[model samples]
Target chain A: MTLTPILAMRWWLPQDAALHGAALDREMYLALWIMTGLLATAHLVMLVGLCIGRREAKRSIWRLEVAPLLLLTILFGWMTIRAERLWAATRYAGADPAVMQVEVVGAQFVWYFRYPGADARFGKTKPELVQPGEGNPLGIDPGDEDGRDDRVSSELVLPIGREVDLRIRSLDVIHGFSVPEMRVKQNAIPGQVFHIHFTPVHEGRYAVLCTQVCGLGHYRMQAAVRVVSIAEFARWSER
Target chain B: MKIFSTHHRTIGIGYLLLAGTSVAIGTLLSLLMRVHRVWPDLNWPLWGVIKPEDYLAAVTMHGTLMVFFVLTTAPQSGFSNLVLPEQIGSRTMALPWLNAAGLWTTVASLLVLLSAFFVRGGGPISGWTSYPPLSALAEAGPGQATGMDLWLVSIGLFCIASTMNGANTLVTVIRCRCKGMTWGRMPLTVWAWLTAALLTVIVFSVLFAAALMLLCDWHAGTSFFVPAGGVINGVVDTQHGDGSPLLWLHLFWFFGHPEVYIAILPGMGMTSMLLANFCRRGIPAYRWMITTTLLIGLLGLSVWGHHMFVAGLNPWAGTVFQLTTIAIAIPSTAKVLNWLMTLWGSRPTYSTPMLWSLGFVSLFIAGGVTGPVLAQPALDAYLHNTFFVVAHFHLVMAMAGVFSIFAGLTYWFPLIAGRRLD
Candidate 1:
């Protein structure tokens, strides 16, 4: 990557993901604005100070106190307040009870997505039958009628404009399912399930990268996700 | 006095060399672990020659060497061991022998940890966390042999060494300042070091006790953490009925979380000082910045429950842990803003130190942003053990911390050596 001139588009990519409008986005939104103001004001001051604050034959002993204390108190003090507010919001992000639940199973080098069958309950699954067939290990049990209605997609595809409540787990090591466009990410651990919620607003495809390093072949372990309309998703998932 | 004279720089240089060498080694291990996952068949993996049992042994050893011997001992302890006294308007901290003992005890700890590699099972694979059931049972893996015992012994020794070092630092900062060096006027770096020492005094000693209990179970046929019905590799293992595996999590994280701040606070403190001095201006909100660091440390101690949210504890434990973890962000955000504020309206230098500080901010933000997601028990249930965590920790523990250490060494090199290596 070649270094661009200062006039070029700043290297920072703006926050635009769907999840960005909430929790962290609001904080970064304020942060970006404060940063811009601070930068401009500081530059103006530095240039002005160099030109005017120098000795230029003026006799004065520099007395430094109080101004710094008060200024820092306000600046950092404000930061603390903003952060505390965001910190609270980041946790208590209450979800509507009507949200749909999806189970995300993470294993060494692979991901399993299980959507409860038409009954809205997870169907029976046996770990022994899981034989990495068609690249889907931890096979969906064909013996149970619930398995027939239960949808097991090789990859994650969500309907646009619908809330998704995620239940994630790992069969072995720790892993994380991450989608940058959604600005959403979370971990998947063994013998324990973790959950988070997000609603995608746009209809498009995005890369789903594994953010945790869970042993060898970690980089090669990646998949793509597509977001489509509810009707389109129903037709695709119904198969 | 003779050793501290003209050759003073060698001590610091030697410290850097040792630290840099271990970092290089650990980095290689991490990279290789990445590679092994990416291409499991790679025959040339640096520590890849070991079998399943030995592979795990290496895992435990790798974390011990990296976090304790390399990260903890180097920048704050080793760097200050050489430079802080001189910079603080004194010859050195009081009780130089104890300081020397702390260093050697650490070296001894490293020796014991490394020796696990040559034991019967090669090394410990139970992970650096060394969770019980896996660690408590000998049949769990090959390193569970005498190797596991040595790993505990080394950590116990490290606790002693760290406690001693922390005490030395605290006493020196409080008692030995020169006439011109008042408490408020003392460098923020000194404040950070003293605070870290106080934390170690409270946290590391608890670890020392945990290590003793674990050691007793490993040898004296007693079970402090190993629970009943525990079967490793089909062998019935012996463990006391009273001790719970969760105790290790309680003991370790109590020390572990603060231990992380101990790594970061000094680096952030260095950022405050170098940026303040380099900008040719007094630090912005210097007092507030100092107080924010102390606040972060205090908040850091209370947040250990965050790591144990999934440990199947009290039903309400996750909620409490989640809240406390979120609460820590306030002080941290205050820290982030103060650093950038100090650079405002000043004659900023593009020195290597300054560059690393800039890099530090970016990495800290990157690593810290994911913290909230993990704090939620429901959220972490999915994200645990995933690549996202790799991204988070490497950003904070390895990447950001490494950048700060790099900047610190380079900035202090001139002061430590009198002749610039650059």
Candidate 2:
């Protein structure tokens, strides 16, 4: 069996499947072009020096080196400014109040997602009330009035083109909530809650992966993310 | 008695041997992981099926060994011990006994770390970072039991050894330079070693303190890292509360980011020295290269927050880290340009050392470019903990350091052995 195909694999990134993925791809390509240009120039200079330059013709061309350094510094600064804007748009910008909010709690080997019911509020949770399989995987207080209609599902269902605010949590260990296609990842820390927002650009099924090595079953910790139409999402939520 | 004497050269050779052994073992572990990745279900007669726990253990060991033993040991201790004194025209280190003690301590630490595999739980799967709650609670996984304890002990010991080694190197460079061997005339490799030693002194101390705190949480019921309300396997751990795992992340990366520079700076030094020597000319911007090395080291400290961007750090703090991280590219780019300029307008020798130096430059550039992308908090949110990260770091830190080590070994083989391998 030849390993050529595996060794010759050229693609380094997974497909862009999120609404903002195109921006990331563009930034990546821009970085690639800059890097390639710099690398080629450096190698070409070395090649010319080795081939044609006389050994005794050593001269300190400080300006030649400084020129590129200045250019690179300006480019890097501009890129950073642009990146800060993109980052702010994703992280610092407040999530839209009208969008859907989902609570995702990661465990040793599973992902549990909770959708606020028609009330649009999450129920109170206490660590003492957590029981994995006895109808309280996320430990929602049974007595809390707001939790009565909360829909807990093993799978994550999001509506296409609609923004999602995910408040990620963990029950035990640190687990990473990663969806390669959606270009989203955040660590689910046991004692902390992390919020990330993204909109699904395409309608399809994607895998929710645990990127952190949580435990023995870390590799198998996954759930299906189904992006459906708004009507279908509403129907699923009602059920 | 004389044969066992604590000479700097002997100590250096010992460190190299230990580092070489670590590289061998670490490579074997990585190969095992690769095999498991390609053929997950393959069962061998002796090793049996690769269990998930086993895979994690192998990964943990591979990273720990490579980072601590091979990268840290070979470049700073292994190379510096033999060459630093000679470069400065000193016959011995400022404190020869401390050098030997550091080497022996490192050896003992390696033994303790390897003994984790023999423990009942069979090595910690927490990876090299050993993030808490998972690493703190024994009930979290099989490896978190006795194995993690041994891992911590081993690391604590190694940190102590590295501290001693760094002090010795720093003092030697400062006070022991021979007459007329000014700092300006000293080789870039010597400067690299000095810078690496300085970083080791500062960073390893923090790591040691963190390890002690982690150990305290494990044994003394301290909640330095184990946050409150941690439940593992349906059992609520009631011992510790109010501890934030982010504290561990902050502390670890504070040392960890500089630790990457500690690994690569020496390689950069070696590449610069080799390029200048093989080209038989001065590097175009010699002072700038040294200044940039210092700048990169200083900037490395502030950029550690980039690692925590996806770990739920405040967005504003992430932005600060992103800016600092992007700024680091300036010094790094200057170094690359200087290296190319060193090669320009000279009789380029295609020797093995020169070849490896060229490879290092190319690989470092390729790896350095991806860094800015990850420096962006938005992009890092997606790339963190993925193969993309693994690829970036492996290119920058792992492969680049390995190439420089090869270059150094090849360049110095003849001087040490009186016969060149080639």
What TM-score should be assigned to candidate 1?
0.67
Whole-model lDDT values for every prediction: 0.67, 0.87
Output the worst ten-in-a-row residue range by lDDT, candidate 1 chain B: B229-238
Pairs clashing within candidate 2 = none
Candidate 1: which stretches are off by over 4 Å? A1-239, B1-14, B45-51
On a 0 to 100 scale, what is the lDDT of residue A172 in model 2? 87
| lDDT of candidate 2 over A87-188, digit per residue (tens) | 887788757888799999998899999998989999998888889779887778989999988878999999999989999999888899999888888899
Docking class of 1: incorrect
Measured with C-alpha atoms, the lDDT of residue B384 in candidate 2 is 89
Candidate whose lDDT is highest: 2
